[model samples]
Target: MPTPSTPLGEFDLIGKYFTRPVQRVALGVGDDCALLQPAPGMQLAVSSDMLVEGRHFLSTVAPERLGHKALAVNLSDLAACGARPLAFTLALSMPRVDERFLEGFSRGLFALAEAHGCELAGGDTTQGPLNICITVFGEVPPGQALLRSGARAGDDVYVSGTVGDARLALEAFRGTVALAGDHFEQARVAMEQPQPRVALGLALRGIASSAIDVSDGLLGDLRHILQRSNVGATLEVDRLPRTAVLAAQPLALQRECTLAGGDDYELVFTAAPAQAEAVQAAARQAATPVTRIGRIEAGSVLVLVDAQGQTVADHFGSFDHFKS
Candidate 1:
């Protein structure tokens, strides 16, 4: 165990906190390279995400939640592709060793990893500004993995869970919006501990035509599918799913938070109208709620509509690393 009295070396810190017995990987920590064996007839799905202090998260966030969020974001990418979690590698950088921080972080990281059967492969730790990078690996059977380029005209657009609450929390943090104590805490949990819809992705394998995780906001992320599939969409802005707190906000604020509020980590997907029942069944099986918010169209233009079928202009762009 790490102690505050003695300076902890990198190898000692890793062994004390990050290293664990291998479950899914052939080789875990303490190796040149971790070995992963995919199931027969399965294709590997991989994704990497880096979180920086002040940019991705606030300085005051608990180390436990930070650890959970770090892994959850990468898992969201796998969920977008209808892939099953297998293993992951973590690269951590911090100014100095904090025993308490490492203990809480590893606890939170391993809890989520064990829940999804994802093993920690191997990684590096170094002294620097606080940053965390994780590369996750998953698997899907051939011809079964979903992609952003599979959407076609006439497909129904759907989103899992809710959106905008994370953005709502962010605005609260920035003092742009004032929320009630309970509401703020609810939104804070949404922001810091997003639930990745992995089971929903697995259930929608054959049912969804295309899918993308809502990390960079719904409209912005959905636009990727649109551009890749060479199609357009008519999104019913009023139909965007959100929590009660977001719903009670002003209409413009609600739209901004739900439409351009990044970090929701929900799955946005498309399917044919004929598969509506199947989509519902899949949602039920996964124990996740999904809302049909739009439909793909032939023209390469995204149109936003209100409840009364009136067209609304989209002014709320999504989060951009360079622009935001």
Candidate 2:
């Protein structure tokens, strides 16, 4: 537990670990709050997400990684909308705060914030069941934020990065697998550390007709864009990038994990068929692979079809927001 005079005093806590990096800014960390100066005509985008132990992550997971992922996932939302991360406010509530935990948490958080170009603004701190909520601010050109409703019939669907590693990692982390081996390492890292597709998301702004981050199952999350865009999708099973670690598993398990498992912060987007080359080039530049996973159709259902066009059942069904 932390006290006023504890080594983890909020002042030192903020200064030693949460320092903001230099970037395109109206202000840096330290003040009533961090201020921002958006370039002329750019609009502001704000988003937030909370991570709770034993819910969003395991209670035994390291605090530093939890801090990083909580922030990174929220930033992923901003990136999905083609926004440049500007600043963030963190709200931390823990049952009992330890100095080591605080220090490690802040260090992990700042490292990602620095890479993502977001400032650590002001927010409240308190005692609770260890929930980390991060609200991030971003900037995008006026009237140009990517919306989920922009997908059109005939647009090619795409996704950045592989799927399922995070979910596999979570299961392994919870001791579900004793034989996971190096596969466990891959999945654990994917789960504990999420790389928000900031650059790809930004580049896709004007190009992708619609986009979303796959925090939920890929099919479930893609349905959001398709539903909003008033179209259907035919997901191609062959194109999903399954890591070697993930592929070594049984086929059914692999498909189930990739389609329904959450926490892989990859971009699922739709673009004109003419833009496929550009999308491929941009992804190449970022050194991130983009796979052409499907095509938008005129119907309203998001369906999966094999190369032979046979329909597959919902692998794990849509991830439920609530259940007993």
Candidate 3:
């Protein structure tokens, strides 16, 4: 073979390791620029999110998990919009470089990207507190992107995966929830290494009339759908997804984690009665569990309910950036 070095530099690192795969991009990994050509009759969706140390996450959170979460959260947004993740860019900041940290972080980030067939195109690096920002791009058919505003009265709301695990995991890490051996390890993983529900989101594309991922607490995020769709909702408290560990807590605490605690990143969407079957089938094929938690009504309000269908008092909880 020829000499290994052929003027390859930082750009080469990006192109070789971070570049998007050949599946979706119209262009390759090199050149002065990147060109994208959306598939015929398809619309492109783009989303961006930022996480700062000591703000979005605890400073003590592990670097590998932090890197994974930073990218997963952004991908979650694209999924909610019914988009297939095509590529992404990362912006990382650090006060000082740590080789171990960088290695683990890159491993975590690239692992998810490969699973989803998304590439890390390019991004900027700078000096500062540890902060990771990811911007992702995706594509969906024209006029087919699910949105918060599409829900109508009588549409049923659904959620995928267990809620409150990440929150409970956080609690365990903070020394609040005591666990024995692997239980603690498992919960910590849930809190740190969250998996974005990309497959489920893609599967729900035509099935979900309105969609949003549970980024903010379920209640708060459901409020987003209600406000945008101009509809009211009655969410049954018992119907929400909860892990056994999370449920083992006091009822009030469980409700808090399920309602206001964030980082679930599970897809929450609304479907018409006729679409429920298709929704069920899609989730089954995707191997993700989905639960019907509530229904849409004609107003812009969210009401909580008990198993008896009695209206429960509004908790008004969920992560609010301004408040947090």
Candidate 4:
């Protein structure tokens, strides 16, 4: 129940924009707390992501896209753990309650939630600087959640879809790189509304020994897996998959962005060579194309090598909030 008060008040804003009925949860919005019941023999997978204006995203981005991204990033975490989305909670802070902004934002948010069969349970709203934080709940079968520390020597490394487009778009926006009009729009879409590889993650559940989402740059995120698994990797720099938009850029820029560019919500996973067929079959089932870019090896350092078998020196850096 919402109480009437001043125009665009807190309760009124929630009632008008955020309130919704939930199906998978025991209770949804308008309650003091959201209640959830886990299915038999399944474990809950939860992840949270926060997007701050100017830091995580630009002011020029559309509200709907921001809404989609706010939830998508958190869902990507669930996907990496081979979990199916169950529900989510959104905590939004805005300077004012603008009806038009709320309309677009809610529309984009719920659209993706529905696609994954995730329900909006409950959350809080406040008046402050623009920020969107989403915590997503998912379920994975017991003993089946993919982990980062499971990679083994001789496992093949793979990445889903293309990378670097989002980086290219960001560079374009920063005036550091230039793109043709059509190319700019394509790259912009990649940055604004990255598609989390949820289906592909599910498909790779039993196949991938170690899995992670490429939210940060491929090399950087892959480093996390190597560190966790107590192994290393040799990536073929020329073999990284890139879209036409990124391909049009110079080879130097391509390598720099593909190796260190962040914000692309693709999945990178490793599987044994013997499971190669199963990996391809899973990709086909998920309708997501994956490219093998490297292999796990018996070391603790990541090495980049060219086709000529020479060690490649890359000074490119990946994103870090405090250091970068």
Query: Highest lDDT among the candidates is held by which one?
Result: 1
Better candidate by lDDT, 2 or 4: 4
Report the lDDT tens digits of candidate 2 across residue range 90-145: 88887765777887788788889888868776676777788888999999988789
lDDT of candidate 1 over 185-206, digit per residue (tens)? 9999999999889999999999
Per-candidate TM equals 0.98, 0.92, 0.90, 0.97
Question: Can you tell me which runs of candidate 4 are displaced by over 4 Å?
Answer: 1-6
Model 1 vs. true fold: TM: 0.98
Ranking by TM-score: 1, 4, 2, 3
lDDT (CA) for every model shown? Answer: 0.94, 0.82, 0.81, 0.90
Model 4 lDDT at residue 17: 81
* Reference-based lDDT, residue 211, model 2: 93
Residue pairs clashing in model 3 are none
Of 1 and 3, the candidate ahead on TM-score is 1
| Candidate 4 lDDT by residue in tens digits, 31-145 | 7999999999899999999999876789998989988888889988998999999999999999987777898899889889889999999999998999898999999998889
In candidate 3, what are the lDDT values of residues 1-324, reduced to their tens digit? 223545334554454435555555666555555567767888879999999776677877776787788889999998899899888878777775555676677888888888888877667666688888898999998888989999999999999988887777777767877877677776677777878888888888788989999888888898888889989988998889887777778887788888877888998899999998999999998899999999998977788998898987875567877876
Candidate 3 Cα outliers beyond 4 Å, as residue runs: 1-32
Q: Per-residue error at 264 for model 1, in Å?
A: 0.4
Superposed Cα deviation of residue 19, candidate 3 (Å)? 6.1
Better of 1 and 2 by lDDT: 1
Q: In terms of TM-score, which candidate is strongest?
A: 1
The model with the greater lDDT, 1 or 4, is: 1
